[model samples]
Target: MTMTDNPPAVADGFVVRRSIDIAAGIDRVWAAVTQPDLIAQWFGDRCRLDSLEVGAGGAFGWDDAGDFPFRIEEFDPPRAIAYRWSNAVAGALDPLQVVDAHSTLFRFTLEERPGGTRLTVVETGFESHERPDAVVEDHRQGWTSELDELVALVEGAA
Candidate 1:
């Protein structure tokens, strides 16, 4: 797996964008991202989703990190999934009570390549947080490591 930081010129400085090519088809990669079971294998230790449709809500957490509430903003099967969540107050408050000021938007896009899938993840809105630089840097590292894990899981299965 190869990850690159490609923040769009139009985006605010707080954005963290990464793209990687995985040795798997779009369907397999999409399932790994949207399904609770497969998402847990790479994203978090566990995940719970109310629904997979746009406007649906859910929670995802790890043993070390408490759950965070998330609302789906966009859902396009095998292609894209966008959600809003409060990572600014991650383990400090009840995620269910998160407001727009405390949340960031995360988007995942998948494009079918000749031999595999190109997966891109972009997280924005860190400027709303108290510590934008820290938050953005933290997520940049987090995404890099997490995406590497995702690549390993999907490619290993292939």
Candidate 2:
């Protein structure tokens, strides 16, 4: 995975292109990504997953925030998982007004590299956001920290 010294470029109100290398096997990385319990340790404050099967749906959010509804639009075990992220109502929270106009896609690609696994996350379809730059930066930091946590968790460094 290429570690960019700069954040990815924001194109059409959407930022794309960032990858991370984890010192773990694809299976380990896949588990950390697809499993609800482990995902929260790395990605979110809390994760509520119904299934990892293709076209399945789930909700994941910070413990302090409401659950964000999501649907598994595409899934390929141990290789890729693409999902639709929404700020819609999950538990008493109204639909996210800021995210209502934009439909974002999160794609996770995993590959077995020579030393470990290379994980790439690409999010697109953000040209509709009023503040796309801010959103991009938010995700940039979020993914970076999450990937770091994932590496630590899978490598027993945490």
Candidate 3:
């Protein structure tokens, strides 16, 4: 339940991270994240996940921003899931198009907290991005608003 407090040095390391406590159980939070239908309610307008299998492919789309392709890098049921996605490009991205070091990886880590669940989304690998500032700013602000919506959706359902 204890994560490192230090943010990685900014020289070459870039990260946009956010953690929020939701007044819901882990299962509820997990469903909101992993299930495509529920993901659409919070994260993106369209969630196209092939499946929940670890290596499955997926895409999150916004009418204005375009589709971003991603592959499941890690899947651990209701506990965690990590997605490696192509952040720089939009629309019609192939799952295999993401180069390991070039693309960004965002992980959702869930921990049971008293009377609720603590969900943390940490996105790294921004240093490889052509416009790291734009990427960070986009996600930094996105996560803030997205997480607020997540809390509203999940807690409201409870």
Candidate 4:
């Protein structure tokens, strides 16, 4: 199939998106998110969630960086959590810094399917006039690795 024939319309650089049906209930998945220790184990290298309240905020980052610059844009408990994130490395090929707005959206949605929970992650709005392709691919690779890490941690393999 030609590029046009593909229905999903993959973006130019990298349309990096993936979802997995985790063999755990929504509650388990929710626990993995709201709990700071569990989140650090699964998703973040290190994380701090302020309040679980809908309007409350949180911060997270990899090992070296203490916390990523972000606030909870939306919080719906076990259903969904949408937050803003930024890497802030100007002119260094860092994808997360593409947006001049100082933040990009990272949304996680959980659905209860027949066997387990369907987890969906979306990190978008990385189109910058400076470095579009590099930014897109960087986040794509990062998210891919992140999802893999999440699966491993949830399945007790990591």
Clashes of each: 0, 0, 0, 1
Per-prediction CA RMSD (Å): 3.4, 4.5, 5.3, 7.3
Candidate 1 Cα lDDT to native: 0.82
Query: What are the Cα lDDT values of the candidates?
Result: 0.82, 0.71, 0.80, 0.63
- Predicted candidate 3 versus true structure: per-residue lDDT over 51-154, tens digit per residue: 89888987888878887778899999889999988867665355446566658899999999998898888888888777888878878878877887788888
Q: List the residue pairs that clash in candidate 3.
A: none
Model 1, 69-132: lDDT tens digits are 7889999998999988877555676767556788899899999998889988999889888888
The best candidate in terms of lDDT: 1
lDDT by residue (1-158, candidate 4, tens digit) is 11111112124443445566676678887777677788888666877777776555556667654456556777787899877666555333343222336556767889998866877777665653357577676777666666666666665521
Task: Give residue 143's error in model 4 in angstroms.
Answer: 1.6
- For residues 131-155, write the lDDT of model 2, one tens digit per residue: 7677677776677677777777877
Best by TM-score: 1
- C-alpha TM-scores of all predictions: 0.89, 0.80, 0.86, 0.75
Winner of 3 and 4 under lDDT? 3
Model 3 residue runs over 4 Å out of place are: 1-13, 92-102
Model 4: which ten-residue window has the lowest total lDDT?
A: 1-10
Residue 49 in candidate 1, Cα distance off native in Å: 0.6
Error of 1 at 53 (Å): 0.4
lDDT of 4: 0.63
